[model samples]
Target: MISIVLIGTGNVARHLFDTFRLYDKINIVQVVGRNEQALAYFGQYSKTGSNFSNTEPADIYIIAVSDDAIAPVSQLIANVKGVVAHTSGSVPMEALSKHPHKGVIYPLQTFSKERKIDLKNVPLCLESDQKKDLEVLNRLAHLISDHVYGISSKQRKSLHLAAVFVNNFTNHLYQIGKELCEENNLPFEILNPLILETAQKLETLSPCEAQTGPAKRGDLSTLKKQVGQLKNDRLIKIYELFSRSIQMKFSRD
Candidate 1:
């Protein structure tokens, strides 16, 4: 059995714990956190501890805390042996320099407490210092998902930035859609189908090939109307930027 311990109990931690629990070979030794209430919430299924000393260590320790907390949390577990990995995108493995063996197990997707993650579809981006450690990560990842990538610290950093653009920025656009719907007295449900269709299309078609909208067709009238109606300067800027980019893509030789 591969013994493992998880740190933190936030959205990412909860999602991972639920997924890891499904596999009998994977053992969650303990979930550690400073907050009494948060640790208590996750303590129901497994052992919980408020500090590293009280928590029973395992073959692998996963620090699933925020990017900012990675360094500090890692510092607390510096003396522990075995492979210590963090589930962060931008943070470097050197952040856990205190540990001889360190790596990343970053899942490239947005996490929310309300949203149930389908682990099989989520790509587990894993890396490590030792060859044997990588094997462990690969085996662990395969247990939860089919799409596992042997990504490095540097590649993960770039992918994280790209995720910010695609997932984070796209969600902001959805928020903009909600604000627009409220302003125009329109029901937001109408956009739901469009959103689903756009995402579904991406599974089969390249984004460039699947592109549609007034910008792609060079519809001057609609573009002008939308630009004129955008009360938010930032939204207008984004619209203009994407419009110009789309026009360039189609009109270019």
Candidate 2:
């Protein structure tokens, strides 16, 4: 079993730790962070401490901190004896170090402490300085998931950008829907099935093919009436922008 030392105790770090417990393929020897107090509770089972700076390395050192902290944290991890990796979608693999066996093991999913990652289904995007190191990453990935993909840093970044639009931006729309429901004294849970169905449908149909709306149909009367129903100024503006974009995309005029 690969001995892994996980760094960072944030959302990603916490999720990865739970994944280790679920898979049982890797021995999580330690968890490190810059803040001692922050990592204290996690140490109850595994070895944990402060100091992003490396004391000793195991088979793998995974830095699952924020994207902006990637380089600075890696630089602090001195005296690493094994392959080092980070979990970030947009960051490049080379940020680790040219001398060390560096790689990126970025999981393409939104992680929340309350929501557990179904490791058997997560798609891990991996890249490395050498083919052999990639094999190590692939092994670790396949231990938890069958959906490992070999992606270049460039493609990973592109995919990350697309994810921001689909996941983050789309969730904001859902929040707006929830707010509207609350104002109307409707239970937000009422939208759960609709949301799930919308996601399921995209698996079979392209978004353009699945598109269903007054905007897509160019129903001018319905579109105008729907905008009039929005009480919020910002949402009305957003509806206008999206409507224009959708119309332009479909109509081309």
Best by lDDT: 1
lDDT of 1 by residue, 130-227 (tens): 89888887888898998999998999999999999999999999999999999999999989999999999988999989998999999999999999
lDDT, candidate 2, 6-65, per-residue tens:
888898888888888775678888888877766864877555777565445587789899
Most TM-score-accurate candidate: 1
Q: Cα deviation in Å at residue 20, candidate 2?
A: 1.3
TM values, all candidates: 0.94, 0.93
The per-residue C-alpha lDDT of model 1 at residue 124 equals 94
What lDDT is reached at residue 205 by model 2? 98
Q: Candidate 2: TM-score? A: 0.93
lDDT of each: 0.88, 0.85
Query: In candidate 2, which residue pairs clash?
Result: none
Error of 1 at 171 (Å): 0.8
